[model samples]
Target: RPIFWVGNERTTDHIHSILTESEPWFEFDTSRLEYINRIKFWRYLLGNESFDADYWLTRVENDFE
Candidate 1:
């Protein structure tokens, strides 16, 4: 499946209502850093604080139109 988020990085203020109601989401314990063909990636689990979730809704709309 494809995954994405919408808006600026600070996105929790938008989706907390829906996400907080359903489950006890947990943040990753460590950064997901890896190397692929000498290219390195660094991903940290800021949990809800990570990406702008509002971006998700926007993406859906974009796809629909």
Candidate 2:
């Protein structure tokens, strides 16, 4: 059978796990889709560290509280 994310908790966990898989195929289409669909808000609020923690953290310290 197949697994599916039911609600928000299961959904978010599934997403994080999928990113960790880190397959090449996952990186382009799948990852981009994930970013656009689920992660876009983070990029908007956090910008790219949305994905990059190093850049993001420094940016936060410099730009935000």
Q: Estimate each model's TM-score.
A: 0.19, 0.22
Top candidate (lDDT): 2
Instruction: Put down candidate 1 lDDT per residue, 1-65, tens digits, no spaces.
Output: 12366546544443333332332343332211111101111113443222433243334335542
List model 2 lDDT by residue over 1-65, tens digit each. Answer: 23775565553445444433444667566755554444445556657644632232334347643
For every candidate in turn, the CA RMSD to the true structure comes to 17.6, 7.9
lDDT of model 2 at position 19:
36
Tell me the lDDT of model 1 at 53. Answer: 38
Alpha carbon RMSD to native, model 1: 17.6
Top TM-score model = 2
